[model samples]
Target: MVSEEEGKILIRLARKSIESYVKNKSLIDIPEDTPETLKENMGVFTTLNKNGMLRGCIGYPEPIKPLINALVEVAVSAAVNDPRFPPVSESELDDLEIEVSVLTKPELIEVEKPEQYMDKIKIGEDGLIIERGPYRGLLLPQVAVELGWNVEEFLYNTCVKAGLTADCWLFKDVKIYKFSSQIFNE
Candidate 1:
């Protein structure tokens, strides 16, 4: 488990990194105080919003660099690369709320019955990734209540997002994984 102090440091460093990037209009190199040793040890996601509606959400599934460095990349990516929405505008920054979720390693599951998620899954705690037939979709763990979606409904929506049949994940080739995260809004 990460200590509270460590979490706070990451939060501070992450926010600073984003602010620097925005100010420079380019990705800034990770600062010396930012922990580079833990880059590959953490995965990060960024969710941006305005007036409580989603603006952009983007992340990496596995730690590619220390958490702070990853945060810089993700925060910028969420602002610019979320295909679902246009790039975040400077005006939106003042109105925008940012959220950071640091994910744990995902657990793969074999589902004989898809409905099993109701009992086997714990919303708000388990980030989910569903894959089948070259299609895949992922929802950070906190997505459940925000969308009011049950497991099947959640999976179905994910399928739609990935351009697959809702039931496509029922196939033997399908893969499922659940992970947890530490989430906070800025």
Candidate 2:
């Protein structure tokens, strides 16, 4: 678990990375004093919110690189590369509140019936990942709380995000994975 101080460091690093990229098109060098725990290759996402609305969100959902490295990469991507929203502008930096979600590895939820999924899911506590063939989608844990959606709605939306039908989870070939996150924001 990350302490409050560590979380704040992550937020600061993310903001610096975004600002550096926005103003000069360069990634910030990870600070020299970064804590070792913050350097673990954990699954991490950087979210940018402006005036309380989502501006952009992106990250490495898998532990593919050091958390410090992933922070710099995804923070910049969220600022300029999220296709759902336009690139964040330089003026928006001051108003942008940054969030970091460190995710646990997603575990496939095995159940005999689609109805069983509701039993396994824990709304605000669990994130969802839906996959079928080559398509996949992920919805972070806070998404449900922010949108006030129940399990069914969350599952359906994740399927759509994966470019599949809302009921795709009912199919035998589809896969459902659930994960928890350590979330912090500023």
lDDT of 1: 0.74
- Report the poorest 10 consecutive residues by lDDT, candidate 1: 31-40
Best by TM-score: 2
Going through the candidates in the order shown, the clash numbers are 4, 0
| Estimated TM-score for each candidate | 0.86, 0.97
Candidate 1: where is the Cα deviation over 4 Å?
Answer: 35-40
lDDT per model vs. reference: 0.74, 0.92
Q: Candidate 1's residue-wise lDDT over 103-179, tens digit each?
A: 88778875578666667777777878887767778888788868888877767776776677887656677777888
Pairs clashing in candidate 2?
A: none
**The candidate that achieves the highest lDDT relative to the unseen native structure:** 2
Model 2 Cα lDDT, one tens digit per residue, 1-186: 678899889888899999999989998898899999988888899999888888999987888888889889999999999999989888888999999998888889999988999999999899999999999999999998999999999999999999999999899999999999998888
